[model samples]
Target: MPASTREAVRTAVLADSDTRWKWGALTARRITPESVEPTGFVLRGRATPTARQLTETGVSDTAPREVTGAEFLREVRDAEARGEGYDVVVLALVGGAVRALLQGLADLGLARRPVIVTGYVGVVYEKLTDGLLLRHGADVVLANSRHDAERFRAVYEGVGASAEPVVEAALPFLGGAPHTPEAGRDTLVFAAQPSVPATRAERAYVLRRLVGHARLHPDREVLLKLRSKPGEHTTHLEEFPFQKLVRELDAPANFRLVYGHMGEVLDRTDLLVTVSSTAALEALHRRVPTAVLTDLGVREALGNHHFVGSGLLTSFDLLDRGLVPAPDETWLARQGVAADTPYEAAFDAARERVAALLALPALPPVTPYYTAETAPGYLPGVLARHRLDVTAPEPRESGLRRVVREAARGAYRQGVQRVAPVIRRLGEL
Candidate 1:
């Protein structure tokens, strides 16, 4: 595709309804053309059919309603057509769904061009899809953390790809805020997505360590905070259903089981525990005592916390003492985490690096089939392999249905081709 044509496809995908629904908050709310400053683009939504627009528009509800597959396809097609005009498309779903959705879109003839796709950690589908999109025609992939960024690179570097660490739209806690530690309570907060790999086994070990420690420090309390429920991404681990581990520990009346925001929970927390999570960085930013007990590779790549004496390779030793040891501030400073600052300078520095990395011409294919000199080299292959057959529309449907159908097929096929390598590698590992 020509550069202009590629730009058009990206514009359509970003404008797709699914992108808006999943990543709407991050993309549309934070990074829209309007937010870029000076070159703000005014968003122009397409006009609805007169008769359809005339139907009674009801008040919005808190609960989200599900869209049927047909409706979903139609919305994507609309977005694909619109993607050509936009620079980015933020996918809000988990990594897995994002991957599948991309394939689905490609199957409908909507190519993953020009637009960038961004998403969060909980959306596993988003993770998978974002990588695929990068490999195909996406200009950039935005990851939530350095850990995630490195992970993305390890998985999809060969695919037309590069990732930047853009902190997701999280609670802004930069300014110094008073957070009273959950004093006298021997609590460890598990704030990451419960479905993360090896979560249960890891949690089990941590819990046993905590239980042993609590018995030693009878005065201290141990609180475990869990998600409301197991999300779709949670595969192997059994969640802390009804705070099961809390009850099973059955140590003392002082022990508490809590749920909700880590920032809020951290207010009363003496210690934070996890295998490898972005939350540990959050905890360290707030000066919360933390311990790293796993060998998750990204943690190794990112390096360990210098604050408190706890190393990335440390055991759950604090739990043995029923105490939360303050981190080694000297070590933390080396990692660029400051005791005086409320926000992490390390993260800020990482963002700068990310900006530089993104500025580099994304690594092109060995054959260089998609550049100015080779614009037409693969155009026929793209069109021939991407053609979609729209099912004949009924009299009740508008003529645009055919366009929507074809777009969906093309987008999905493009997704599969892009993500196949990542999927194969994942299976092998």
Candidate 2:
């Protein structure tokens, strides 16, 4: 087929959360040929990014369409029936959701379907085997680092499944100028996570430590870089937010909660600290001085255990003592930070892989490892959670009812995210 005869590649992405949306949209754009622009769809759910959250991500062009799982499937099926199907579809969803989508796609039984692509949003520190298995059917299951790629392949091959889909790629969101000493003011940023230090006591302790550090060094600016504000849903549920915890402490003017793009915050930052946020990777990629806190103990629950050999782990005490640690070069190479390598070239293999898959006559049905036969007890529950039942016909809805349903869903999300939290806090009081 000649390029002129064939229509341009049509790409679409479906993501469940804001962070996943960022990863999926950017990954789609990167893998797609330069001439094509990918469309983005936000899956209607609790974790769906608000307009403000999406804007903060800086992925402005796509203008994501919101869709329920059933609606998205119907759209894909209808498009394929019309012979105008998307060429590529990226599933930036949770593992169970990805599994459900795989089952749904498999059931569609289209003669031709989009080349499915899926991957993590960032440093995958937990649920290694389970997550990988759920995403096994994607045409390309991107591994965000060389370290991840190896582990992903090992998990699949160990389980007697094919590891062909795993592709080595750097995090799409990792980029910015290398750090240089700021002329006027020096900044130190603590990249906060939503639920890592899940308990209020733990979160409050961290906040008090940050405030203490700020009081100790008022001249050097200290920032608590928060992921989301109250009432805003992110990739994870923030049961105990740093914002509320900080209000209890008397802090210097230099210590403040700032929210926006993490890369932008890193720009002015002389030192970046975190328990285990992916922002640490971003900071390290920029060659900024970074530290992983051991004050919480190098525990798996906190996720700092993932940084065991990074040579960046330290306590606030060490930081207070003027300790600045350099990242181990070998570890950086394994993690695909590749400070010496061209960032653009990181996607070369992924692009080539996508191009090759697209060139095939027609992709076979998505064959996930956990079929009804393989995972009889567990498979149905996963599909049911997403409201995906391939055995039954998709429900029909009137336009008026759909409008009402979407509106209701929005209200429900707001109540859960905003109203419920306040009510709970009041109850506590």
The sequence of per-residue lDDT tens digits that candidate 2 reaches over residues 232-309 is 788888877787778788889989989998888998999999999999999998999999999979998999998989
By lDDT, the best candidate is: 2
- Residue-level lDDT of model 1, residues 142-251, one tens digit each, is 44434444555665554443433233222222223444554344455544433343344555655666566566666666665653332211222233343544566665
What's the CA error at residue 412 for candidate 2, in Å? Answer: 3.7
Candidate 1: regions farther than 4 A off: 1-28, 33-65, 68-70, 76-88, 94-96, 103-114, 119-136, 145-205, 230-242, 245-247, 294-313, 322-429
Whole-model lDDT, candidate 2? 0.85
Cα error, residue 254 of model 1, in Å, equals 1.7
- What TM-score does model 1 achieve against the real structure? 0.51
Misplaced by over 4 Å in model 2 are 1-7, 389-411, 414-429
